[model samples]
Target chain A: MRRNLAIVPAFNEADSIAPTVAAIYQWAPDFDVLVVDDGSTDATAHRASKAGATVLRMPFNLGIGGAMQGGYIYALEHDYEVAVQVDGDGQHDPRHIYELLDHLREDPELNMVTGSRFLASSGQGFQSSAARRAGIRIFSSLVSLITGQRVTDPTSGFRMTNRRGIELFARDYPHDYPEVEAILLIHAHRLRSCEIPVLMQPRLTGASAISSTQSVYYMVKVLLAVFVGLFRRRPIEAGDRPAMAVEHAL
Target chain B: MTKITLQRGLAIAVTLGLLLLVFELVRRKRLSERYAILWLVAATTLFVLAVWKGLLTSLSHDVGISYPPSALFAVAIGLIAMILLHFSLAVSRLSDQNKVLAQRLGLLAQRLEKAEERSADARAAPVPGKRSALPDHSEAEAEAPVPAQELSTRR
Candidate 1:
């Protein structure tokens, strides 16, 4: 038996939210799910509620950063032992959730585990548009360069976080392009992070917020945010072995 | 007594002076476009009345005095200041609205993250010993939380 919290931020996702919530019930029945419906013009909130998910409806849409940050706060308040972010568009495979959580549960120091479509390294289950994938790769490379860790899928929205990750995120989740900025944030806080292979389905319903224009903005803004974070981070305790190296050696 | 040309020249000078002050005020953000219009209108009208004192002064004084150009200029300046002050208050209200929107968005993110977790749980086999989340909900107490309680570092 396990106790976990899943944060699902949705907007105009009426078509797939019910099935996504239903799938979550199938993957981890013991976990409690909360829907942060960010002012959906559709019936996303009502459907999530009917599906037995606790709905936290925002008065207006605040994009991905605000939605995910809400989940971090909830995780902190309710004292969830493990927290995972599940996208509302039904792209993420909830089954891999157990895998991501398992890694964190095994080690107290490992605070963040993200689901990476590229971790499998087999190109299977990669359904994002070519343009989107190209953008993801660019950002992933940029994050890897900044953090000194190769994050194969920097934009992967699916993640499992420990108490440390939750606290850090609750404080300063990026307003947009949370995945990239969140990686930098995890590094800034001296938290350990890893990416695990996961299946991502093509969105069954609507368009993504990461449009052509948004992709350009996401790249520019996230890069700037990462640069600022590097300066803002408290001096990493001198000569402390990097978390990944230590975790891997152990 | 002053010559007609001299009096008319002074009236134009007073109007120009007020107009110059307005240009400076605009640069400092002390006055907005809408309010500036009223100031300019009042200033110009006073200038016209100053030169044609006989008609304006007939009621107020015996012959040569009217609402003096300089006095009317003072009133317009005061009106602009009051109008600008009110505009400042309006900007402050907008700032407040932006703050509230941001706070609510933060709360929404927390709820969405929780929903993602719940949805993940929906996928797995239901087991016993589940821990209660959202202690804010009274119903949470009845159902035990899952053994997978992964709270790594509690404060």
Candidate 2:
């Protein structure tokens, strides 16, 4: 009954999606793949479907946060035991997906596992642009200070969530600059999380959606979002939650 | 006409015009009654201030503003700011709902594609005496999953 789902949120990545889907199926054949095509004008949905993955075509672009939330809702509705997020741009190595799953399986208490390139011994293969690196560093420190958990790559899209995490996100999720805020939300929900070293590949095609000039705006907006999250009321009540099934290992 | 009547008359006219516009929009079903309340309240307040010149003058004098006409401008600016703030709130709520709708659409679309695939597979082959469960080609496709495997072979 250990059903697993790999949620790939792609936006106009026609060139990279086919291989990315192939890589995912090859690396993790047991998992069912759901590609949330984020309103790509190009042939992204067609290409993904051809690549042997279930494609969820958005009528209009809903950014990363909305797309991923849709994936979580699907997972929840389908009763997927675990849902892992893998970027469709081919930046995240699906080979490391097993490692993330392993961390989640090994610890039933942990609700999430994030793939971080900057984790100690992570090999530091492809550090992003200088501006992005600095922004990540600042966000990492800010999130760490608030959550008391040292997150090396707060901006990493490569992450996995359990049933608890999925339900929490399906109810409410950050719409803009989600990765970092999502980490904070996980902490707010009092869910456990861990990060392991994972290699990040350079984007196979298309420049980053966030341009160099937008970095400043990105920083300010993210910082504001994170701080606002600290004061906002917690969505889930701790008292009324049902106890999770305790299992030793997968 | 004196300066007072010219300025006050124009203010009253504009306020009345706005009030009438709101009523027209609501009548045409273009503006919701909920939003019309804000516009109605704003226009009514301005009309009151424009018609009662003494209230405007006394209020400005009590507030230590030397000029009475300037008070009308001040109140109008303040009301405009409040209306803008209300609009900002409405836009934020609409965007949040829009995101939820988009998410639901994506999920439902995926489910539809899957159903389409299953029916398609059922129709591809027929049992020797039994009719194809799905007679309609379009219907089968609706229930069947997209033929992703076929596209993979093309490359």
Error of model 2, residue A161, in angstroms: 1.0
Tens-digit lDDT track of model 2 for A23-85: 999998878888999899999999999998888888899988888887887777776888999
- TM-scores of the candidates in the order shown: 0.64, 0.87
Residue B8 error for model 1, in Å? Answer: 19
lDDT of 1 at B74: 57
lDDT of 2 at A1: 27
Per-residue C-alpha lDDT of model 1 across residues A61-153, encoded as one tens digit per residue: 767786777667667766777788998999988898888878888878899999988878587896587887787888888888988988999
> Pick by TM-score: which candidate is best?
2
Indicate which candidate wins on lDDT. 2
Per-prediction DockQ, in order?
A: 0.11, 0.35
> Which stretches in model 1 have alpha-carbon errors above 4 Å?
A233-250, B1-155
Q: Taking the tens digit of each residue's C-alpha lDDT, what string does model 1 give over B1-155?
A: 65667756877688778877887797798988766776777666666566666644563454334555444455557766766787797675564345345545555565577678775764563555343443434355456553444433221
Docking verdict class for candidate 2: acceptable
lDDT of 2 by residue, B1-155 (tens): 33567888898899889989999999999999998898888888888998888899899999999988799889988988998999998887787777777777777777787678765865675566333454543444566655898758655
**Candidate number with greatest DockQ:** 2
* RMSD (Å) of each candidate, 1 decimal: 13.1, 8.4
lDDT of 1 at A17: 92
